[model samples]
Target: MGWSWPANPALWPLARELVKATETRQAAKSPLPHERETVAEIRHKTEASNGDNVDRTSAYLTFFRKHPEVHWALLAHLVSRNAGWSMTDLRGELLPRLLPANVQQDYFSFLERGNWLIFHDAYPQLLLYEESVKRQTTLFHLLPELHVSVFMQAVWNHFWKTGDSKLLTVGLIMNEQHYLETHMMSDETYQTTVVKTLPFALQEVLRLNLILFPYRAEGQEDGALRLAGAPVFHFASLAERIELGKRLYSLLFTSLRLREGAIQWASDKPHTGSRKDFWPHLFHDLRETAPGKAHQKKLGGCQLLPGANRLYSPALRHVWKQVRHEAPKAADWYPATKGVMRQLLLSREQPASFCAEEAYCQALEKIERAVLAKGKLFGS
Candidate 1:
């Protein structure tokens, strides 16, 4: 059966309270009561004042100053990380306890609000939250147990070929999510990667969760499942970022659901409809238009500078790399040629250049076509 999750709009005063509490925190020089060594104080003290660390701090403070409501997201990041939040756990114990099915509609609400905000440093409070380390370490050890429990409930999506009830696996086949959409593997090797890698990804999630919140219960695990610890090519002494470029290109091809100049994402299923009902509609007007094969939407700010970064638990933002039910057109592939090269060259000066982003996407497009043959042969 296709999964279905109906929307549970806000019922409890959680949203309102969260907003008010956050506002209070931001107003008082953005410090906690009894908080020592403030961000402002630290900023005042730090010698290194350039790059993302400095820039994000400035943006972080300025963003909060303007959008105090964003504090809810910030708080969510802190609480979920410390609480060791897990979607599987929530469905099994936490949600039922925090909000039983009997009272779910009354006390808790689940909304598929896509990626929340643009990427930015969420660690501005690390200095104030002294207990974060102890809390995260405790959570780290709990991963193995959580892993077993979570794995037991996992629903493999036509990927796992054969498996016993004791050990289920998404037996990897060469799928579009892989290198140029083509990573052939023996069943043995594929399963090994799945086994060794799942836990690694989980650990990565925990580490990332400490600083960001990837809410699996919210169906935000797609990116984590899709992406891996820096691709093997990252360490190779290639002249240019050949591996990184290919991975990035493949990622763009398999992940994004490009829309009307905006990136269409397969959001976490809400508590409103079947996952099936929800998914098919995404590509309808947004990703696919009439005369579908001619022109494809370009990946731009819609993807790279997503607004969801602030809305999602910060951890989710990090794993937002993997997406599902992607629909890339044959026309979407590339020219990793001079364009991508040019973008790479220019990116040093322009951190987030549309040209650079587009070039990589085009590169992915080229690679996909080379591997999969314009997606049409594969009936894209």
Candidate 2:
């Protein structure tokens, strides 16, 4: 049977209170009463901040200055869709109110041009919060036995969501020797390159439970189910998320510059035997560190960047190469591209450029034609 998640509008208030109380109790555990008091005060302030007649901009500015972490929690509320804040509201009002003028303008310009908000720095806190909520409510609770609470928090989504509300489920595939692996087993270059970087990604996921899923064993005794997907983590309150976001935002900025500089530096150097192999690996490393979908959205202010042809073509080629014998012509690949591209366009600050628009449109057209061709061949 297919899966579906029906809206539970009635649960909003109950869920909100549960989240608040849980957060407060967790905060009170701190040795310092001041920390606890600050948490409590923030909660009260949050209640007061939601006034219909009051100026929300001023309220947010003041609240943000004092309790920046609240932004993470509030964002979680927005992301979870337990509250009414849409992407439109976030783009139009909340973002400018929180971010600096220059940052806001840069992002706004990007949004004005059609682009996908998939990069890491462009994420809005609200969207990150929503993904976190979904991860927790769906995956986390599913595995109650595993204690992954420490890594679960509001800011983790800064590392997750694809800026298009397309949830990313990361799997850190490992082998018996504790080395990382990918599907490209025969290719030595792909395997070696993936191995080197896989550990870092694995460590990050393990440390925070930010990105997690399960993989089943090939051969299991009596179908014991060797691997079961679990809930990664859960944050105590929205405040923690905001605090986490501040820390992560700074780190993300540094990481981006370092990556750009490395790419430039590698390009300048003379390549020898090992360096030839290493250079491409360096690009792979850069891709790993590249900002996630959420960051791209908020950073570009909602720009619709072009989809990676290199990425799409390879997938299409792989499917055609591997499965063409069974399904001579299949349309499965096109929908993924169409859906992602459409989402990217919708998230863009403006329509894409002529070239980019034409390319994606053509890509879409090709996929549609492929689907039709398959339908004619199969008569299904």
Candidate 3:
């Protein structure tokens, strides 16, 4: 679909309603000033970086600052796009030199601290293994977290390793994961974006994910992350899969809510064409074209992911079948999933400025739109 604004005046009615709904909500709440301005700032960057020498960081932040969840979905898209060449270039040329001095120092510290919200550093061994797999014959692990990080880093590292794209990508994913995890699980009190550019920093890494690991390696084997002949794909049969999926799902929900809340805020904020006007139409378009939305009605109602036939893999298919059959015996899975998302919304940390909050909201909203379109729960 075209990213350009629709030229047809016919579509404006939907867009106008979006603006009204979004702005009306803000007017009632006494919206901040900075929040209103940043939307324009982001839009400017997004447009500027659309050319040949696309500022990977700018394009991603422009997209992510408005839609954080797209970080992953798009990362996957990019990974699968150019056979890892473009992403490799981005990692090599941009990541290391991208940030300002203080931002760089703070980013490194965030990872070192492992605060779980702003930074995530994978074991160097995992990186080594992933590289070996990409070039050699090592058994690729199916553990989603491990697989995701490796995919993100390998593509990033493939372009260049002069600095630390591996670590940077890990940190970026962890930041989003933590932000959502903390917000979802915490109460009404929590600090948002411990540091500025936190979301933008994370976006950079996500863009790299799309550059590499875009597709499931055709000949790649599965079931490596599983234990002995338990139920191949279902969480019920595999203890590790169940535990991980549970955590991953929870994290995704938190990320989703955080993102949605941000967008809601952005659409309402002042300046930069009405985000409110843009949202509903975007959602409408998404509902029809999003890769994820097609099966939402069916999938949303399913009790077990493994039981759903929508999964693309045989192993995954087997797992869902088991999960569906065993779900009656399982306790409530919604608490960790749904409850957390609600909690994150209720407990958002106040931003440093109105614009920061607005930016955060825009970033989150962008992700939400992508998720709605793609139907994936996890954020990049």
Which is the leading candidate under lDDT?
3
Q: lDDT by residue for model 2 over 75-125, one digit each (tens)?
A: 221111211111121222123233345543333232211111111111222
For residue 50, model 1's alpha carbon misses the true position, in angstroms, by 25
Instruction: Compose the digit string of candidate 3's lDDT tens values, residues 206-309.
Output: 33212111111223343111000011122112233333323322332344343344333323321111111122212121112223234322223212234433
Question: What TM-score should be assigned to candidate 2?
Answer: 0.17
By TM-score rank, best first, the candidates go 1, 3, 2
Q: Model 2 residue 55 lDDT?
A: 21
* Number of the predicted model whose TM-score against the real structure is largest: 1
> What TM-score would candidate 1 get against the native?
0.19
Candidate order, lDDT descending: 3, 2, 1
- Per-model lDDT: 0.24, 0.24, 0.28
**TM-score per candidate:** 0.19, 0.17, 0.18
